[model samples]
Target: MPHFTTTDGTELYYTDQGEGQPVLLSHGWPLSSDAWQVEVKLLADNGYRAIAHDRRGHGRSAKTYTGNDMDTYAKDLAELVKHLDLTNLVVIGHSTGGGEVVRYAAQHGVGRVAKVITVGAVPPQMVKTDSNPDGLPIEVFDGIRAGVLKDASQFYRDLTEAFFGANRDGSNVSQGAKDDFWRQGMLVNLAAAYDCIKAFSETDFTEDLKSLDVPIFLAHGDDDQIVPIGAAAIRSAELVKDGTLKVYPGAPHGIHGDYQSELGKDILAFISK
Candidate 1:
């Protein structure tokens, strides 16, 4: 297993494959880099270098009690990029990873970046506030925290249904995908996973999204149960300096899985442009 030590000495596991324009990937909350397997393979096979790292406290990375917030998460990504010495990069993030990418560019600068893409991402804001009436309520996130504390395993299992739109009529999500989702969710440390609820929900990425000088592609499933399109992708596009928004009808938050082929083609096409 390949790993890199961050400034705080946390070892984060990552994978690098293929060649050509570098494409850095970031996974969602409670998921390791394994969640990006399909995208990694697609990018690599298509002649782009695909790189993904497990966020600290998730997957094979150190599960610390602290530093589970967005600022630290972005710093870790910056460390990984510095370690690899990559430039003219395309950074793609999913869900919580999307917020990380935006913060990374805002905090670390985008001199090395060529483009940014976020899929089923959480940005601008996810939690409801005075200015953001479209966001989800804090009670929803509280319910999630309660679920994680009471029975993390069952929480993940139940979440898999909504996460992949398994509960929808005419849905055909495979059992393997649900099982894999559960497996990935269980790999994170309990404390870190708990902390991440606040990180992803409360951390405002409004200023971060506005700061990007590079072109940003915002892709979201209109039917995403986790992060709604109107509050997340749509709002984010408006905030970004140079943004393009693509909505996938009838797709779920796990668009990278169910809509893999379509999402892959869109991603490749975006990068090419």
Candidate 2:
């Protein structure tokens, strides 16, 4: 029930737990902070203060039909950081949240930030443009928007399979895991989910990546179907001044959840060092 008001007067919800150096987690599109349940437990048990938030119009936050862009999303996080007065924090973002972390660091400045990590993140830009020919086409995102608008529940169900690499042969997909993903997606507002399609797809994080001074850990799955690892993750690592890239073979976009133990180990080691 803890909430903070953004500069735009919209109330955003967040969960702050444990005590130690802070680790702020920003989740992907159509999902809420609930995505970090596993990571949060690991961090908390290992002596780190963990914070996770529902982005505006997602989860328990205000669900408006507009203002679901990356700039506003980043600003909403900024307000939450300021409210907590956290310092020396580590920000970890997945998928669209990775774009948020990049923009937040570039725009707001990581005055108190020590490091950042982006997993299967959309950055530098996801949609193919005249400048970035390697990016995904706009129609792909358009399909997502159309699908979610037409049938949100079914869209989320299908998304879960693709996200966790369950659609692939020999892939281990849990029904419970897929159900949890659907539950989170269902909790979000359809309008927010629809608008966020454009937000994550079109927002270019090139300048943001070039501007960040903090150390960054970029991890992606070579088999990611949602956000191709080569196009987004690999390219983003090249842009960061102090960035390291790690690719997991046969992993999917939801590598954070699919390979939580391994990813958590990598994150813990990075933060400890």
Candidate 3:
């Protein structure tokens, strides 16, 4: 597997395929580049170079005890993009990966990225504060941290359904999908996974969203059980200057799984424009 070394000397694995305008993918918390498998093939088949990387401590990357926060995550991404010499890139981030993409651009000045998309992203802040009353409470994240520390494997298994709304009786996702998700989660370093809970939940992306000059598309599911659309996608769409929000009515957190066709069509159209 191809990999790149971060500023902190951690090796992060990434996949690059096809050729044309580059479309870089960043996966969500506790997940790996594997999560973007569908979109990567879709973009590559459509004449675009698709790149997806495993965040540090997840997937095939190093499982370090340090630098598991947003700042480090963003810095790691910037180095990877710069090392590859990709320009005019359309960066797509999902869930917590969205936070990394926005923060990288905001803090590092976009590098060579021209467009961005955040799917089921966490931004404009996920934790509640005096200013953002609608945000999820700190207790919610605490519960997650506590759960992971107690029994990470079991925690991940239980989260399989809620994370993607697969618990529904008529849910379209297969049993294998949930198992795959659990497999990836369990592969991650326990220490790193435990630390990232704070990073994803507490980091503020409001400034990052405000600083962007590029166009951003925020696609989210209204019925998202993990990151609610109202607090995440809906509010994130409102913060960016040139943001386009698309709400998948009744769709759950795993929009790509059940709504792959719609997401693929829309993503291609957006990239074209």
Instruction: Please give, for residues 74-154, the per-residue lDDT of candidate 2 as tens digits.
Output: 988888899999889899999999999889878984687889999899998999999889999888998998899899999
Off by over 4 Å in 1: 256-258
Ranking by lDDT: 1, 2, 3
**RMSD, each candidate, Å?**
0.9, 1.1, 1.1
TM-score of 3: 0.97
Residue pairs that clash (backbone atoms under 3 angstroms), model 2: none
Error of 1 at 153 (Å): 0.4
Q: Count backbone clashes in candidate 3.
A: 0
Report lDDT per candidate.
Answer: 0.92, 0.89, 0.87
Q: Which segments of candidate 2 are over 4 A away from where they belong?
A: 256-258
Q: lDDT score, residue 233, model 2? A: 87
lDDT of 2 at 244: 93
Pick the TM-score winner.
1
TM-score for all models, in order of appearance: 0.98, 0.97, 0.97
